[model samples]
Target chain A: MRILVLGAAGMVGRRLIDRLLAEGTIAGQAIDVIDAVDVIAAEIPATGRITIDVKASDVSDPDEITALIDKRPDIIFHLAAIVSGEAEADFEKGYRINQAGMSHLLEAIRAKGGNYRPRLVFTSSIAVFGAPFEEPIGDTFLMAPLTSYGTQKAICELLLNDYSRKGFVDGVGIRLPTIVVRPGKPNKAASSFFSGIIREPLAGQEAILPVADDVRHWVASPSAAIGFLMHAATMDTERLGARRCLTMPGLSVTIAEMIEALRMVAGDEVAGRIRREPDAVIEKIVAGWPRDFAADRALQAGFTADPDFASIIKAHIADEKQRVAQAGA
Target chain B: MRILVLGAAGMVGRRLIDRLLAEGTIAGQAIDVIDAVDVIAAEIPATGRITIDVKASDVSDPDEITALIDKRPDIIFHLAAIVSGEAEADFEKGYRINQAGMSHLLEAIRAKGGNYRPRLVFTSSIAVFGAPFEEPIGDTFLMAPLTSYGTQKAICELLLNDYSRKGFVDGVGIRLPTIVVRPGKPNKAASSFFSGIIREPLAGQEAILPVADDVRHWVASPSAAIGFLMHAATMDTERLGARRCLTMPGLSVTIAEMIEALRMVAGDEVAGRIRREPDAVIEKIVAGWPRDFAADRALQAGFTADPDFASIIKAHIADEKQRVAQAGA
Candidate 1:
């Protein structure tokens, strides 16, 4: 088996690549790391083919992806996307890169006809749903996205299901919760604070809480996100069939619980670095998002995540400790 | 009120234009018409400017729509789309026109971010929902589209809702049921037979029945579809708020009932013109579509349709009879 990781330079993309490389094989084959495509240059933990290009650079330029498919990667992880904040702010750039770029990749595979059926694992987000909450949203939720980014993701999910049913590819779209305890410099996603409240405090830096303590959200750690992708790639195809999209399992908690978890993991001194400053824009956008989701189907499919908020904090701490040890800092 | 009709050459589009012209006003204004864009060259029924362009043109080109919107029509009736059969046959064209074309319109509205909130009436379809019947599909049913056409429409619906809520455009997406007794040449839509069986028989011609008599479907008359577009344009924005997409009311009946209605209207001789031809492809596709839907929300919002299937047939016959008399054929 061989694998191709699109957007291999991004945070989740980088971690997913690490997981795949560390595993070394898929479906019993001695897997080869065929390619990694991204705008930013990615460091490979192991020797692998790489093609770094902006997703806009004529992805269908047959030369870009055809050679890799000629080698026929058994699995393709599509993790590329503009974050919600950027997409909502820059409309043209958002649709061009996120929507049109994905279409370009799908069209490339479709051009191959019956020659291949690679497991195409696409990382979608909960942002695909918006505003009115049905309370603990079920597996079967209509994608009424409020943001451009969510709309783009929902569009891609629809395309993935149709192409999969048409036998063009074996596709799976996993709608991940906002990955909490995200180990990185703070980013622009409004939900970034879901991770930052914990991550920054743990790293001995001050972090601002934009919403009220009562504000709730669904979350999964980075490890859980990687696990969801792996499960999506290898799951029983018959169960998914044409409707290839599923919301991944996650723990729902209030911001207060997140802070409590931070205090437990890194002590109150570390938690003291967090500050509260409410902004209406953030509150309004966050209000439209789903606070909790009942991912019963994913759980039934044997996909698991951190069962509680504390576990998520513990996972983040362990991950940060490992990074620190590697850096010798 | 000024109005712009995007697909003014279509059967429904032409009828809508006629209705609006006959009424002489919409929402209390003198009903000034602006332009009509369509694939074929045609005369506009309304005393407005006319613009004809292929539905398959590069609609993303700002120049294509800028001139039309220069007048800033108060209402935009976006009825343009490659029908189900054509879209399924030509996948790339479907995405380009149905998906990209819609984006162009939305982007245009977003670019002009002042008090220019035109009421955008987008024609959606029940095709957005596929199999596993829930009897009457609610407003919150998941968009698990079976075909590429349905997928395109669903994507557009999401974009319309998002853009509208963001105050870019005051949008309303109306999910039209298959129009029965379509008064025109036999089109290639899989569902065309729903109209063809009735219309062709009334015209004293043989009509092929691809599926069995027991095959059930949701349908609306051409007039009802027009009513839906008008109602969507003029409805209370506060009640609709962010959720601007709706499933319009339609009559659900099996092929046998349709034939019965035909027999009542034009006698057994005309009904007997319907030929039985079992087609598995049609059967397979139809199987995944909802046979019945209770659009209670639409009805509650004061939008209505023919109470019975017989009434639907009578309306079609009455309208076509006038058309035939006017033509003096």
Candidate 2:
């Protein structure tokens, strides 16, 4: 079986590629080739067994998307999108990539008519739900995103279902929660602090906490996110019916819980690296975000989340150790 | 105020145009130019006081859409769309007109940067909510359209919210219930029988009832739908906040109730023109439609529905009389 991974340069994409290389199979079928493409090309030497092509490409371009789909990979993991901050700052770019990119990809696949429906696994975001939702938003809650980034994702989710209904593509959209302990420098996303507070302190560096300790948010570890994607790619979609999108199960934790988890895993000194610096702007934005979700459908679908905040922190630490060892090699 | 009406040839569009012409004002501003365009040109003679241009144009064409936007009408009533049956049968056409058309229009409006935001009144549909919803689908119920047309409308609603949020356009999307007793020949839509049963009988013609009498659905009069459009055009959008789309109030009645009302309004002889010809295909299709809605938001926003099924039949009869009078004149 062949696989295509868009946004392969990103953290989740990289880890997914690594996992695929190690497993060498999906849905119990031996893997043959993996075409990994992203806006920023990734560098990876392929194993002699499987053909891997990591290249730079813009998904917003219809022709480029068509060229990519011409390969007819058995499973296509679409993870490319403008980040929330950039999408909000630039409306045109947000729709072009986040909204239109999905359209172009779906159209490209549809153009290859007649029994050529491939499994297209798309990663949506919890941002799709804005304010005014009940605590622990149920599976049937409406999508009233407050941000352009969220709007784009919601629109794509609709298209994914419609296209799949028409038999053009076998699609599954998973709305992912914020990824905790991201191993990267802080970017402009207001929620970036969610990860920075965890990742920075683990590296013996200072981190900023812009929200109150009691403020709650939904999150999952990077490893859990990859598992969700894998399960989405291989799961039986017949159970999904017409509703193709599902909010993946996530750990709902507060800043205090996260810190306590950090202290338990890395000691008091490491937890002390986090400094309080409340920014009203970030706080207001985060307030509108979803705090928790009723992931009964997702859990029933056989997808799992980290057991607790401590498990998420432990997973992040273990992944960090692997990253450091790889860099050293 | 200058007004532009897309899909000016449709039943609701024609009625909307007529109402605008008769009223001679919107938001208490004196009427001015009205550019009426549709895929099929509508013949509407201006009242001599106001300038009216009715022409044939495809909204799917971006250049044509830009040209229309170049006029910069203060209020744009976007009522264009492929009906549910056509959209489902023709997927590409559905996306082109229902999806891309909205995108192009929004993009064109955005291109006219710096204080060029127009009040875009979009006509969405109850089709956005499919089956498996509660008896009365609330305002916040998730949009899980079972049809491609519903999917397209749902996507446009998201775009309307996002674009409005960005201040590119002041938009209001009204999710209209099915317009009952439409003044037209029978069409291929499964729901066409809903209108036919009332319209054909009232016109002293035989009509077919394609489903069981117990089948329930939501519906409103043509006049009520026009009221929705006018209210959407003039209402204070400041109250809309981030959520702009609203489910317009409608009378939820079963087919039996509809026929009983027809009998009361037109006498048993006219109602007796009805023929029971159950269609399994249409029954299956109509079964998935939303049967009711909780229009509390729309009511608070001053949108009203026809009082009852009898009132709806009376309104249809009144409109038919006017049409006959106009044709005779």
Worst 10 residues of 1 chain B by lDDT: B49-58
- Chain A TM-score, each candidate: 0.92, 0.98
For all predicted structures, in order, the TM-scores are 0.88, 0.98
Model 1 bad stretches (over 4 Å) = A44-72, A112-114, A185-188, A200-214, A256-283, B32-34, B43-63, B108-115, B200-214, B259-281
- Report clash pairs, candidate 2: none
> Quick one: how many clashes does candidate 1 have?
2
Q: How does each model score on lDDT? A: 0.81, 0.92
lDDT per residue for candidate 2 within B150-192, as digits (tens), equals: 9999999999999999999999999988888788799877788
lDDT of model 2, residue A191? 87
Q: Which runs of model 2 end up more than 4 angstroms from their true locations?
A: none
Q: Put down candidate 2 lDDT per residue, A1-329, tens digits, no spaces.
A: 98999999998999899899999999999999999999988877658798998879999999999999999989999999989988988878898999889999999999999889999999999999988888889999999999999999999999999889888999999999999878879988788999999889988899999999999999999999999999999999999999999999999999999999999989999999999999999999888889999999899999999999888888888887887897899
Report residue A292 deviation for candidate 2 (angstroms).
0.5
Top candidate (lDDT): 2
Give the candidate number with the greatest TM-score: 2
Model 1 clashing residue pairs (backbone): A69-A72, B131-B288
